[model samples]
Target: MRVSGSGAGSMWLQLLLSLAALWLSDANEPGTAMTTRDINQQTRESISDYTVKGHDLSTSGSHLTTQDFKQQTEENISNLTSAVYSISIDGFSSAPVEENVILYSPANIALLCSLTGTSTDSATVNVTWKKDNERVESSNVTINETKNVLSTQYTLTIRDRNQMGNYTCVFKSDQEVKATFNLQVPQIEGKEHHVVSYVGDSVVLVCKSLKYTPINWIWYMSNGSDQVAVNDSLMPDKYIVDEKYANITKLKIMKISEKDDRSYWCQAVFKLGESKGKVSLKVLTYMTPLKPFLAIAAEVIILVAIIFLYEIYSKKKQMHAGTISCFFK
Candidate 1:
C-alpha cells in the first residue's frame, strides 16, 4: 500500500497497453472472419439468383418461337385447303364451241369463270350467265373496270354431280360475244381399250359412262383421217350396235376381217355436250399364232436329218474297210 508515485504510474500504463493489445487481437480474429463469410454467402446467393433468372428467360423465348411456328403452319394448311379452281378467257378471241373440262370429284370446289375485254369507246354492256342453255339463278356475276379494260367474273360452287354442265357467258354490247365452259365428269374407261381378235371371230367393242346417262350413243369408225358414221343399215350383217343400258354401248363386230383393224370412236351425247372415247381393234389371222411352233418344228427336223446322214456314212466306211482287209488276207 505504501508505493511511490512514479512506480504506480508506470504500472498503470502497462496495464492499459496490455488491454489494448488484447482488444486488437480479438478484433482481427473471429470478427473479421464473420464479415468475410457474410460477404461470400451474399455473393453465392446472387450468382444462384442470376442463373435461375437466365433459365426462365430462355424457356420463355423458346415457347414464343414454338407458338409462332405452329400458327404459321396452320395458316399454310388453311390456304391449301381453300384453294379455288378456275378458268379464264378473253372476249375478243373466238371461243371454242365446245370445251371439255374433266372433274374427278365435284364437291367443295368453287369454279371461277372470267372474261376480259378492251374497248376504245365507253358503252353499256349487258351480261348474262346460263347453264346448259338455261339461265342460272345462283350464279354470282362481278364486273370490274379499270382504264379501257373490262373484266367480268362469275363464280359457281359445285356441290354434287348434278351441278356439272355447260356454263355460258354472254355479253351483249356493240357486238354479241359468247364463252362456254363445258364441265363434265371424267370419262369412264376400262382397264384396256385395245382388243385383239382373229379373223372370222366375233368381237365386242365397249364404252361406258358410269356416272352419266347419255341421250344416245353413236359409233364412228375411223376412215383415213375422217370419222365415218357406222350405220347398221348399210352393213347389217357385218356390224351391230347393242345398247342395252343408257350408260353402256357395245358394238358387236361379226366376222372380223383385216379391214376391221382400225380405231372405233364411241360418242356419248349428253344434254350439255358430247364426249367421245376410242377403242382400237386389231384383227389377226389364225396362222399368226402357229408361226412360232412351226419354226421350232423346222429346227428339230433339220437336226434329225443331219444325225441320220452321219450314221449312214459311218456304216458305209466300216463295210469298205472290212472288204479291203478280207481281200488282203
Candidate 2:
C-alpha cells in the first residue's frame, strides 16, 4: 500500500475538523451545559421542596413559618411592655433583711408585685400584705398554688401622697420569710442645684416638697467621702436648722468659709423611707467677678504710659534739632 504524502496530510486535517464540529454541536445542545443563571434557577427550585423536621421552608428560604414568626415577635413585645409596670421577687431565705426601693412620681400609678415562695409544701404556705408594718386590707391581691409552687400577687395604687409607704410581703410556712418594698416619692429637684456665694456670707440651703410633708428634715454635710450630720448643738455658731413651714426646711450656714464649699444633702424622713436631695455650695472671694475687668484695666494703663513716653521723646528730639540748626547758622 503505497500512499502519497499530500493525501495522508489532507486526511488527517479532515479528521481533526470533523472532531471539532462534533464538540461544538454537543456544547450548543439543550441541557448539556448550564449557564450560571440556569444553575441558580434549578437550585432555587430544588430548595423549595426541601423540608426539615416536617416543616417546609418558605419561598425565600427562611426556615421559620409565617405564623410562628409572627407569634414569637408578639410575645417578645408583650414581655418588654409588661416589665415596666411589674416587679418580681423570689428566692427568699429565713432571714431577709434587704429592702427593695421603688420610687414613684406624683401620678396615679399602680404597682404590681409578684412574689414566689420557695417552700415545697404549697398547702401550708400563706402570704400576707402589710404597709409600713400594718396589715393591708384590699381585694386586689391573689394567691395561687400550682405544681407544688406557691405564688402571690399584690396590687398597690398610689392615689395620694399619704399612700406611699413601705410594702411588705410576708410568707408564713415552716419558717417566716419577709420581703419589703420601700415605696417612696422621688426627691424633688429644683432648677438650680448650685449656689454661689462670697466667703463669710450667710447662705441658706433649702429643700421643699409640695405634695409630701415629711416627718422630719435632717441636714448633712459632706466630709471627704462620708456625710456627717449637721448638729446645731455641736456647732451652734455655724449651722441653724429652721422650718419655715410644714413642708419647707432651711439650713442656714452662718459665715460660710472656704471649707464650707461642698455638697450638702437635705434628707426628708417619711413614714416609708428617707429621700435626700443634693445642693452644692460654691464659695468664692468678692474679687472673683472683678478679675477680668482688673486685667483689662492693667493692660490699658500700660499702653497709655507707653504712648506718653513716646510723645515726650519726640518733643526732645525736635528741640535738639532746632538748637543744632541755630549753631550751624
Candidate 3:
C-alpha cells in the first residue's frame, strides 16, 4: 500500500511538471520579443519628430543595440554631408554615447571628414585635395566620451589669385564616414576713356561707359611724352574741367593769343583703366595786309591836310606883314 501511494504521488508530480514545461515552452517562443528592426524603426520615427521641432533629437534615437545605433548614425552622417549640413549623433543613434563635429569654411575637405564619427576632443583629422592628391591641412579636437555630441569649427582664407577649387569636408569619428561641398568667388573686369575741350568753348569729349561700374574719373591734358596736366582750377597755362552731365573740360585763354593755338587733350581715369583724347585749338588770326594798308592810308590823309593848312597860314602872315610895313612908311 505504501509503495503504491508513493508511485501515485510521483506520477501526479510528473504530470504536473510536464504541464508546467509545456506552458513555459510556449512563453519562450522565438518571435515573442520585439526585433532590432522594430526598435530601430521606432527610434528613427521618434528622432524625426524631434528634429522637425528644432529640438535636440540626438538622444532620442536610442536603439536596442549599440551596433544599430552606430550604423544609423553613420547613415545620417552621409545624408547630412549630401545636404551640406551636420547632424548631432543624438539625431542618429544612441551608440557610443559620444559625439564630435567639424565646422569648415570650405566645409567639404578631408579634415572635415576625418573629424566626423569621432570624438572631437582629442583627434587629428587628415586633409587632402582631389585634384592635387596632396595633403592640405590637419586639425585636432578634445571631446567627452559620455557626451552625445561635440563639434569644432575651421575657417579657410584664399590667398592666391589664381587658385581655383571647391572645398570638401571629411567627417570621421571612431567610424570611417564622410561628407562634401563646393566654394566659389567672383571675377572682376574694368576699363576707362575720356574726351576734353578748351576753356570758354563748350566741349563734349568724354563719354562714360554705359556699364554702371564703380570708377574714378579725372580730366587732364597730355602735354609731352608721359606728361599730364593736373590742375583742377584754371591756371595761367592750364585748363579746369567743369562738373556737368556732359563732362565738359575747358581750356581758358584769359587773353586769346597766337600762343593759345595748341591742341588740348582730355584724360579719364577709371578704377582699373585710363584713356585720353585731344581737340585741336586755333587762335583768332588777324588779316595781316588789311591792318597795314589801313594804317598807311590814314597817315597819307593826315599829311596832306597838314600841308594845306600850313600854306594858308603862311600866306595870311605875309599879307599882314606887308600891309603893316606900307602903313608904317
Candidate 4:
C-alpha cells in the first residue's frame, strides 16, 4: 500500500485517524512491525515485542530465517547438493581470503560472483568474484564422494561505501543445481542528534535527524541493548550542551557533580545504515585539589628571598657610601 501527504493540516489529521483505525484491525496486533515508516507510528511507540525473553533469540534484522536454515539443511543429502554461506569483516573469517578482497574500500565496485562447471568422480570448483566485470577475488573448493557440503566465509565490509549496485552470490554444483542471491548495496548519509543532560538527575539524549530527511535513530549502551533515556531529570547541572555546528548534539547536565562524569553515546541513523559518536564529561571544580598548600609554600619562599636580596643591596650601598666619604676626607 502507498501513502502520500499534502500541505493541508486537515489532510494530516484525517490520515492519522485512519491509520490508527487500521492498526487496531491488523492481524499481527498493534506493535509487531519493525519498520520506521509505518502509518500508525503513534499507536506503535514502544518496542516491547522486539525485546528478548531469557534464551529466546529473535531474528528480526538478520537476513536468514529459521525456515531458510531448515530448507538448506534438508537440501544437503548423501549427494551434498547444497551450501551455506555468509560474509563479514576482517579477522572474522575461518580461513584466509585474498588481499584485494580485504583492501576493498567503499569507493570500489560492488561484490560479484561467478560459477563454472566440471564433471568427474570428484570436481574442482573455483569461485571468482569481480567488480565491473574485472576479477577481484578467487577461491577453490573440492567436492567428492565423501564430502558434499562446502561452507566458507568471505570477510568483507560493505556499508555506506562509494560503490553502489546489485551484488550477487553464485553457487554451482557438479550437477545443474546452481543457486544465486541478489544483494543490493547500501548507501551512506550524514546524521546528527541532540542530547541534553543535568547533574544529580536524569537526561535524555535526543538523536535528532537532519531537518526534512527520513532516517531511523536508536539509543543503546556500548556493551548491551538497554535503551538509554533522553529526558532531563537523570543528569546533573553544570552540564552544557556543546552546540558547535548545526550537527552538534547537546547534553544538558543538572546539578553538576563527580557522578555525572561518565561515557555517553549518540547513535545517528541514516538511510544507508547507523553510525555512533561518543563524548566524555569531566566535572568542573573551583580550585585545584593541592592549590591551597602550594599557595602557602610559594608565599613563604617569596618573602624569604625578598628579605635576603634587600640585605645584600643595603650592605653594598653602605660600603659604597663609606668609600666615597673616606675619599673626600
Give the TM-scores of the predictions, in the order they appear: 0.44, 0.43, 0.24, 0.29
Comparing 3 with 4 on lDDT, the higher-scoring candidate is 3
Deviation in angstroms for 126 in model 3?
A: 39
Candidate 4 wrongly placed segments (more than 4 Å)? 1-109, 112-125, 128-227, 232-248, 270-273, 289-329
Name the runs in model 2 displaced over 4 angstroms. 1-184, 313-329
Ordered by TM-score, highest first, the candidates read 1, 2, 4, 3
Candidate 3 residues 1-329, lDDT tens each? 35688899999999999999986786688776566898899899988987776565454555235577689866655553222233243321233222222221112222222233444444443323231233345343222334423443333332232333433333343443333333322111222332333434433333332333223345454455554564555473444454454333334334445555555554544322344545565544456447788899899999999999999999999999999999999
Error of 3 at 328 (Å): 68
lDDT string for model 2 (237-295, tens) is: 99999986868888999998899999999888765457788899999998998999999
What is the TM-score (0 to 1) of candidate 1? 0.44
lDDT: worst 10-residue window of model 4: 99-108
RMSD of each: 28.9, 25.9, 29.4, 20.9
Candidate 3: worst 10 consecutive residues by lDDT? Answer: 98-107
For candidate 3, the lDDT comes to 0.45
State model 2's lDDT. Answer: 0.74
Q: Comparing candidate 1 with candidate 3, which one achieves the higher TM-score?
A: 1
Candidate 1: which stretches are off by over 4 Å? 1-109, 112-185, 316-329
Q: Rate the local accuracy (lDDT) of all candidates.
A: 0.74, 0.74, 0.45, 0.44
Question: How many residue pairs collide in each prediction?
Answer: 0, 0, 33, 33
